[model samples]
Target: MARADGPRTANGPRTGGGPRADGPGTGDEGPVGGSGRRFAPWLPGVLIVGGVAFDLSTPPPYTAAPFLAAAPLIAAPLHPLRLTALAGALAVAAACLLAEFHGVRDWAQSATEIATVVTVALLALLINRIVRRGSKRLASARGIAEAAQRAVLPVPPARLAGLDVAARYVAAERDAAIGGDLYAVQDTPHGVRMVIGDVRGKGLGSVEVVAIVIGAFREAAEQEATLEGLTLRLERALQRERARRADIEQAEGFITAVLAEIPRGDSQLRMINRGHPAPLLLDGEGAVRQADPEVPALPLGMGDLGAWPDRVEELPFAEGVTLLLFTDGVSEARDAQGTFYDPAVRLRGRRFAGPVELLDALVADVERHTGGGTADDMALLALRRAPVAPGVDRGR
Candidate 1:
């Protein structure tokens, strides 16, 4: 709730299935890294030799059975099925050879050691099969999750209503590909309009609300004549959704959002803030302005508490000035000592050639500040007014 000087802070409609799925990306590195593959062939050999040496050095009653048993186990996840089988065979053969060298080949203990190696070898092979199967299943699940993410949050076109647009959604969880953050940009009859919002909670519930908000925004952005009108439509949509849910969910669910409209043949932009973060306006000369709302209003779905008329704040939308919109993930990112990240301070004088570079820099700066320890999901959208051609009109 702390306000900063003009530079206060730094910095999708999808519809779909009953429940959403999520996953991280670590599984993609399965068995293919330089270090892993480089040592793969020699690791089994080293283990076998080490097991032999341990067995030879130990007293007659003691054994290196554990080391001998581990050779195939280590190979199961890192090597091919045939290589795993070979590792198991080598371990069994080594145990047998040691038994013979010690003159215990005919002893019951030797047979038991040999049998133990064989049983472990077979189990290692089974483990190899299970790991491979799991990897395949994981790959399949990742693919489906990515597909769902694309369907729900389609990438905005590079150009929208004559403005350059770039958006990014970074999930806080490493394995998670998507979260509750959402954005949508459309070239509507009224001009170009965009909405960015953050759902209150996480998981399926948040995703469901995101779909509802985006679906409603898309429908209203094209038809509503004013930014305030579109916001009212979004509020009604959230209210209807709340009505469909139980009392607990109705009491808890809410969405913070910012809606903007840039009318054609005009040099100014209009915005409606519904308890969302103020967007930063960056000029071509590297100046920044925080477009905070003049009248505060509750986030979407809290109309029951109190209702205030949405105020449309208008600001100059000069050519080459980029407008940045984001969720609390960016504003609330804390450093190790708990100091909040100030995008206004970090990016005050720094300039980027375009929206993409600006967002890339901002994200990198946040990571550096938090030492890569962000707690909430972040969604960023950067829109810049394209430079007019020598003969083109500035507003048309």
Candidate 2:
């Protein structure tokens, strides 16, 4: 069931377009304005000063009530309860002082103006309380999501089966900690087996598929004797999930994945690619090569469409060489100008101390290329064959 590559293409560098307004760098400091400055914290003070100046310069007919009312509103979301209260108090005091300075001949009008200021100030405090409560709820929700993500995709050990391993999962959506992207590595009697995949959808649905795929892989990696058999196990798992759910959408969804096996004491690794981005091989000499599948196969869960024999391709995985497997998020990442990021081309001449360094650099490079505006979740896994010492035994 071989199919052509997806429509996304990797081309030249980005041509034009400024950085995204919501791109990385704007942290809890405050919201960024059009001028790209953190002016939220100072806005209330500026408004108060401006209101005072306007009242002093203008006649009593032209009141600065609008400016005075806006000061507390501006501070509501950006400042704490105490600061917000202070801002409201200051605005009310300014209104009273201005009214007194004008020598109010109309007591009703003066009372109305002061009353309006007090009312707005009270509303601002209410807004501040609501915003703070919502923020606390959001923070608590994020903490729970992070914990779930860790449990679902627990970090692979730094060393596994004599190989240095590292993995990373980056979600494109700011509020999401986990999505359809997933990866798992396990040391089995067969050797170190790794799987990286991207499910077809997003949100909780995709997360369900991710959990199914990974759960199947962990169990199969221990029992399956070959990469081909292991791939079948994953396909069956997804098939069962769809059958159990009995939903048309779940039935239609598929997962693009790569299964890799590194036999103990062997200098080569075997891989079975199921319509996924080809893995990259980086050698000690800082040269990179792509391990594209000899024959493409449809992604898993698409067995209903067609079936083909899974082909296991062997590649050199000698000492000081690192193998990188990733989801389409990395390969399909586009810049402001729509040029897809090509990891092989970008990492061609880069040398890293180990798998951890390699993945860190790749993640940073992808963020830079996309200007931190990736539209999908990314999952990356890299494993390096540790260099053997002069008299060290290579046997497990």
Candidate 3:
């Protein structure tokens, strides 16, 4: 039961995929390599031994396939060139022994052939070298993805001018990028605005939609005079994009989004629900009320078929009140017995110091519920009106 911190140990041999999922990311493979690390080392040994066994039994016609056998062995870069070189030598040795044992050629000819095989063995080390560099570059790309994701979806700073903001995004698949769910929070001259939505598909295509939607929200949230106007703008933007690129809405591609704008000096939250799951507003004391608008607008992109009539819903968000906006992943997540996750009931009245704490707790709870990974991406954005007092300086 010895559990080591994952994704923390400096460029060393990766241990097994210990116990926890959210634990530190191990290996030099960035978060992409976080899912499994426990059995990585033993793989090379098993393959090398198996290759040697095969060589002994068959010999000629069967060249020891080092790459085939030990491909996963030298997967991480930290392993020395020696391991690969050794693997290659083993293959060549098998070739030479088989040449002699099977009497395929004369002794002198066999010796010369084995020398060529040995040279090829060393050359195989170069392949390992190239793979190692490639892994490093891939890890670097993953880091850039993390930074972009943060900037695009800022973790609500501990405090905003008039709101408390906290958020988290979890990819449905392990080691995946942002995928299908997206959330954004920003404070504009008009007020504190937020958007949370789920795109139709997964992978890079869904991420592209997320980028387009957020880009539209950031631009429209500021200029538009009203929340309804903002909704119209977003719907049109989506349709315009679809019209220009007919492939955008291919098969099944649409976005379910909920946009909220808190006027500069009001406790009311003007929300325009666009076929998304209703968000919940938690009272300072931990009571939950589903903030579903009466007139539900169509999911973005299908707006041309029908006008997106926006309805503003008002909720009494007192000082320290928190509004939790989430994609369907959280509510729809099921346990072993098929019980759905109840965020309101589970986190009722719990005091999360800041956004990081809130997200950490939420992810931990979700992992516990699903036992490890959720099938669909989960995105959450929680905004709490900072205790309207004059003591703490809230981060933007």
Candidate 4:
């Protein structure tokens, strides 16, 4: 997988329309966005033996010996190639010395061997140049990818006022930092509303849809007082974008979303589910409950079918309650035997000191269940409300 940073070229300094230093805006988009690079590893011994054999077999009065000396270039860049060239020269010199062991060394023979050695040495130098240049390019590419990722998805804060907020994003495609998974939490006039959604597919198409959905959610969630309205707002926005694309209807793709509004000074938490996996509520007393919607909720982008938003479910998410919202990457994560991960079963009765601990434990549990490497990208978002004062909202 090639990284989205430094791009690959056929050979030489491959040129393309790049960001001009004095151009209009910052060109954060790399040649390859998100997808990592792939490289073929070189074998050392094979090239060395082949080079020696070629030198031995070829009837060369000229310096094909130098080319053979340079054989190790196939294995590495500058450092090893330079060493190999020097080693080849020394070997040739020693071989000549041994041939005339009984007598003084011949000038003609020494000159030919030395010349062959020097030729190979120059070839080694060429290999060194290639390696040094490659490393620099790779480093530059890495820097670009890092900058772009930060711009695309900034790191979430450790805490949000009284709420313990933790969020993470994983790339489905190898080396990709930003994907279709998106989340936004803002303190609005109504309340501290939040959204977690997974757009359809991956790559540029999904990213575009994710941006659209997030933009709509952020705008509507702040303005709309109710979760139902926010759901409708996101759906309508997705619908409008889909209508613009000609081939959008031909495909069956939608956004699975979970929207929540935490009212100030209220133990009850209001949420609207749009066909997404129900969020997990981890209580202070070591209890876990799946907050599934009462009725079958349709995913966003299907408003044309006349699906109704379920009434906002207000669960008792009192102080010290942690809400875990995730994408299918976590719920649908598969084990070695091809079994879907059951968070409810695994996290049952588990005790955690804080929201961070709960998230870390859950992530580790998922990794252990799947043996470390995950096929799908998982996004984990945990929010824990602090324990209120004694008798706070108790009679209310």
- Candidate maximizing lDDT: 2
lDDT of 2 at 119: 96
lDDT of 2 at 298: 88
Clashing pairs in 3: 6-24, 6-25, 7-25, 7-26, 16-37, 16-38, 17-38, 164-384
Candidate 4: residue 71 Cα off by (Å): 10
Model 2, residue 21: what's the lDDT? 39
Root-mean-square deviation of every model: 15.4, 13.1, 10.9, 13.5
Strongest candidate by TM-score? 2
Identify the superior model by lDDT, candidate 1 or candidate 3: 1
Question: Would you list the clashing residue pairs of candidate 4?
Answer: 1-36, 1-37, 2-36, 2-37, 3-36, 3-37, 6-141, 78-128
lDDT (10s digit) by residue, model 1, range 1-396 = 001111111001123311122211122232367765576556666677876775565445445455567788878887879999999999998887877676653365566667777898899999999999999998998888788678777889987767989998889988677788889888888998999989888787787788788889889987888888899899898888787766326533698899998887677999988889899999877788898888887888888888778888999998899999999999999999999998877889888999999999999999999997699999999999988788875432
Once all C-alphas are superposed, what RMSD does model 3 give against the true structure? 10.9
Compared to the true structure, candidate 4 yields what TM-score?
0.69
At residue 186, candidate 2 shows an lDDT of 90
Quote the positional error of residue 283 for candidate 1 in Å. Answer: 2.8
- Candidate order by lDDT, decreasing, is 2, 1, 3, 4
**Residue 168's C-alpha lDDT in candidate 4?**
77
Candidate 4 local lDDT, 94-162, one digit each (tens): 434422432323455445544555565566566677777888888887687667556555566666656
What is the number of backbone collisions in each predicted candidate, taken in the order shown? 5, 0, 8, 8
